[model samples]
Target chain A: MRQTILSISNLSKTFGGVVATDDLSLDVEQGELHAIIGPNGAGKTTLIAQLSGEIFPDNGRILFQNKNITMLPPFKRSHLGIARSFQITSLMQGMDVIDNVALATQANDGHAYKFWKPARDDRDLRQSAIDALKEVGLEGREFEKVQNLSHGEHRQLEIAMALATQPHLLLLDEPMAGMGTEEGDKILKILQKLKKRKTILLIEHDMDVVFALADRITVLVYGRAIASGSPQSIKTDERVREAYLGTEGDLNC
Target chain B: MRNLLTRKSFNFAFIISVGLLALLPLYVEMTGDDFYLDLANRLMILAIAAVSLNLILGHGGMISFGHAAYLGIGAYSVGIPAYYEIYDGLFQIITAVFVSGVFALLTGAVSLRTKGVYFIMITMAFTQMAFFGIVSIEEYGGDDGLVIDTRSTFGNFFDLEDTVTLYYFVFVSLLISLFIVKRIMESRFGMVISGSKSNERRMQSIGYNTYRYKLVCYVLSGCLCGYAGALLGNFTNFISPEMMDWTASGELIFMVLLGGSGALLGPLWGAASFVLLEEWLSSITTYWHFFFGALLILVVLFARGGIDGLLSKIGLSK
Candidate 1:
């Protein structure tokens, strides 16, 4: 029996009469790889924003670990075991990969305000950051700064940062967005491995990756949850076909 | 080992520079050049101010244009208490920091709402407002400036009335500010600021409340600047509303840009260069402001990251 780790109830967000999310409700089960699939501007990013506490919905309730957390700040949400990776690669361009990952680890540690002892000297935090880097197959690239890393490597580093938080649920936005087929396959392998331990809410446009990995898929169109179910069910839904996945559908998730 | 050598070279250069500066007062004393010591003292004080700005601008990626206002506030922190006959040095310094900190917190909360150039403009506007408010105080010297009647006393711990002692005091304050900033910039909050500077929206999605992080940096920067201002008041034996003016703020910002915003030692270099340039220019020509202003414009136009950025680009920077 899979328990729900997060539950969104009747959530809606609008920006100046443009509805971003409309009466959306969903439950993310523990240890499940649930993917949210939609065309561009389908409120997917907005939903992620609200879930991650970056944006507040006009009306909604977010329950995480049986606690109401709609108004919680992003860091608090992260502390409570919800970690997210951005669609756009966002890493400190000046700092090395290990330093970046160690920063994320520092977030959950007792006090980042302690300034005298060098963070590098702390073996425990350093080891965890190293462990996260190795988990993402970025072991040897620890000393490389984000700017020097390839685009695929930046994406991989994003995952490594998310893992450093020791999150129970990883909300990954477009992990394979800019990757080539080879790079995509590499990420798919990483996601496959991660799914075994962490409950993941993946937002991806690649239907093949979506269908291959998502134990359940939710299709969103024009800020509405048009259809949701198994990949086979969503592929056959008529409303979803009209809203998206019809003749003009290119799966720009 | 090359990295170790580079680091050692940086330390050596820093020590040499400080040694040279410490000996400057002796030259002034021997040559009867009061102006030289005065200018050097001004540079040291501004260097302290610039170091604080570096905490926010370099480490946090917050390009605050109004850091000078904190200096103004800090000057008043000392000036106000002394005017009221409450001239305890430590108390005045504490008050200065508290006032500036509160101001920064409130302003940062509103200003940090916008990012990029918008943040800079909002901060600049707030500082101007502070400047104007001080100017409007007719009883407190208003537009003219307030003259301190007595030197701030620290329970006979040191004689600030002695110019040489005061110079060393300013030097020690600069060192302490640098030490504190170095620690804060290397801490976890510092990491968050660095991360947010790269990508704030990404930070949000990762569950870091970047707004709060930025606010903290702003307040810290303001408090340190206040310390500089209080020291400036004691060094000058006067305080003026002009200390809070936009030009003063702009010059401090220029110091940051000229030295290197990111490097710890950059602002000190910048302050030294800026004060020396002004002194030299004034000696050479009466129209020094015009010439110096033109040179500064050129620096801003051609030098993207100031002298430090330029050196780093050419592989000469630390």
Candidate 2:
């Protein structure tokens, strides 16, 4: 049996009167691509936020490698090898692409208190950033400003930055949220390659990509998990079909 | 090469300006006008303060409205010593830096906890507190302010009393400060600070403890400004609560914005233009502030990047 890398027990969060996440529990095994699917307002983002420490759950425990990390801040969680890509493409827009990724590499490599030598001159850091970019198929676009990149490229850069941190588990929120079929295919190929080496917890709206990539799927509806099973089982699960896939329409395409 | 020069003209403009400052003493001597020398000295000293403010206000995106408090602290570090008949230049300098650094550490620790408009208000409140505290010190001239009997002595190694010598000293100090600020901004520490400014949430999520980085920057900026305060106190031969007034802090912010905010030499240009405009306008009429205010409004409306931005437009600056 595969060892569990992440386990959530009794997770709960509420914003005002709205229940964003409710008494949710799930397990993600090492080296498995776990996909969390839900309808709009299903708290998929909220669950990712709590897991990444951006939002604290009202009540819950998050265990990573058997260590309780529910109370830790986002940076501490990042240090413990949890890197997240935002749904809104949270990148340093004014900075060059390479510098953005380089900063991520710098963040995890050592203490960022070095004040004498120029960071651009650090070959190891730059090389690691370049490698991350190369993995995302953005090798030649390093010097371009992030704001100038296409929306699809921004998503790729987001993944590159997350990858640059060398995290054990990648938390991607809507990586293909607004991508065209061509752009989606590019990202799908990159994720396919990544699945061979890295464990990713993805929140996706595209059923084709979800069914294609996910090893185990967790269906969420109104902040509560409806089912957790393999992709084939999740596709045909009576509750998942009624709650999410029934409304999604024509998943076989 | 031409394209490169145009693109990097800001650097060119900076070097030319510094070179002109270096030759101002010669111009003063040749024209038999010593008053210009004093004005130039004031410009360089204020430039130091402006440059320090830029580190937080421009680069770190922390709008601190009480930066002049460090200047006051720095000046008092020298003034309080001289009032006690202690005239050691090295001792005064050390005390000024240490006091200002500690002040920054303590104030930044508290003020940095609050952000946006609250940060500005909190910083202003701290400066006002310092100003009022200084005003209560009746022995140090209270509301009237204190006068230095003699310029700081450097163990007979140098004379700050000589105008030419003092000019060079302030000039070299400005160069050293620019070097230090530039180096820090290019380093890893600078990346974190700048990154935090761009997107603070992203920085935190990327495993950077942005608070510590920002606090360090605040303290560093404060200490540098405090050093400038020491120089200002010596140059004027006076230290006053007026130096730490909220208006004084506002002027420093204006200087940073009046020049391009993020550029290293932006504050230097801002200080020069501001002081020069003040001198020229005040010579023509008593209501110089009206014209200064109008000019500032115009700059804000048209040249959003300040003098540096305008120069860059004309292919004369970086």
Candidate 3:
């Protein structure tokens, strides 16, 4: 049996009287690409936020590597080998791509308060940031400002930044939100390549990408997990069909 | 080489300007213009204070409107010590830095919790509170302020009593501060700060405790401003509640904005130009503040990036 790296046991959250995430429990094994697919406003982003320590769940707990990380801040979770990429383009737009990723790398390293010594001169950090950029196929574009990059390139840079943290598990929210077919295919190919070495919990809207990438699929409907299974089982599940797919399943996917 | 110079052009300009300033007093003495030397010394003190403000407003992205409170604290540091006959120069400077840092910590803790305009308002409110508090201190000259009979001395090792020596002293202190600010801005922590300014939400997500980082920068900026306050007190032979006034705070902001807040040296230039303009305009008319205020308005509206921005536009910045 594959060992679980992240276990969300009965996690629940409520804002005022509305339930944002209701008694949701799921497990992601080590080295698996788990997909959480749902419609808009299905609490997909909120669930990812809770996992990455952006928000705290109202009930139950989250265990990472068998240790409770229920109350850790986003940065603390990042230090403990968990990294996340924002759904929106949240990079330092004025700075170069290499520098953006370097910010993440610098955080996990020793004290950043050392004055008089230039951060760029640190060979290890510079090389690692470059290497991570290369992994996302951004090798030739390291010096370019992030604001100048295309939407597709920005998405790639976001993934590259998360990769630079040298995360054991990557939490990506809406990686392919706004992309053309070619761009989507480019990211799909990259994620396909990365799946071999890293564990990923991806929240995606594209059914095709989710089905293609997810080793295990978890369906969330109105903040509740309706079904959990392999992509093949999920495609055939009646409850999932009624809740998410409905009559327009063939047209949408 | 041109790209490299442009990257740190503000610093290069600062060095050249300082070199010119060092030779200025000699030219003034030759021409029998002692008044220009006095003006130079005054500008130097304001430059020192503005440079400190740049650390927070420019580099740290914490737009504080109450930074002059530290200047008041620093000035009082010298006055209170001198009034009590504790006139050691080094000791007075040390006390000023400590008091300013403590004030920064207490005020920044409360103000930093809310961001944007709220932060500005909170800082302004605190500065007003300090201004009023000083006014109510009837023992220390109250609303009129206090004066020190003698400038501080370094335990008889050196005397800052001479005008020529003091001008050089203030100039050199500004130089040292420029170097320190430059060093701090290039470090790894500096990268995090710049990163936060560009995208704070991303920095927080990437594991940086931004609140702590901003607070450190705030305290460091305040301490540096206090050093300037110490020098100003000795130079003028007086300290006043006017140093903590809201207009004084606004002037600091204007200095940072006018010089091109993009680089540290810009604030120094901004301070010098502003003080010199005030001196020149006041000679022509007593209501010089109206013109200065109008100029600032123009800078904000048209020259959004300030003097450095204009210099860069004309291909002269580097």
State the DockQ of every prediction: 0.45, 0.62, 0.64
lDDT of each: 0.85, 0.91, 0.87
- iRMS per model in Å: 3.3, 3.4, 2.6
Model 1 docking tier (incorrect/acceptable/medium/high) = acceptable
Better model by TM-score: candidate 1 vs candidate 2: 2
Better of 2 and 3 by TM-score: 2
User: Candidate 1, A131: how far from true, in Å?
Assistant: 1.2
Put down candidate 1 lDDT per residue, A42-132, tens digits, no spaces: 9998998888888888898999989999998788899899999989887778887888898888777746666566566667887899899
| TM of chain B, each | 0.91, 0.95, 0.94
Fraction of true contacts retained by every candidate, in order, equals: 0.53, 0.76, 0.78
The residue-by-residue lDDT of candidate 3 on A1-253, one tens digit each, is 7899999999999999888899999999999999999878789999989998989999989999998999998888888889888898799978878889988888888576776777766768878988998888888787788999999999999999999888899999999979999999999999999999999999998888988899999999889999999998988888888888785465135
RMSD of each: 3.2, 2.1, 2.2
User: How do the predictions measure up, each by TM-score?
Assistant: 0.90, 0.97, 0.95
Judged by DockQ cut-offs, is candidate 3 incorrect, acceptable, medium or high? Answer: medium
lDDT for predicted candidate 3 compared with the true structure: 0.87
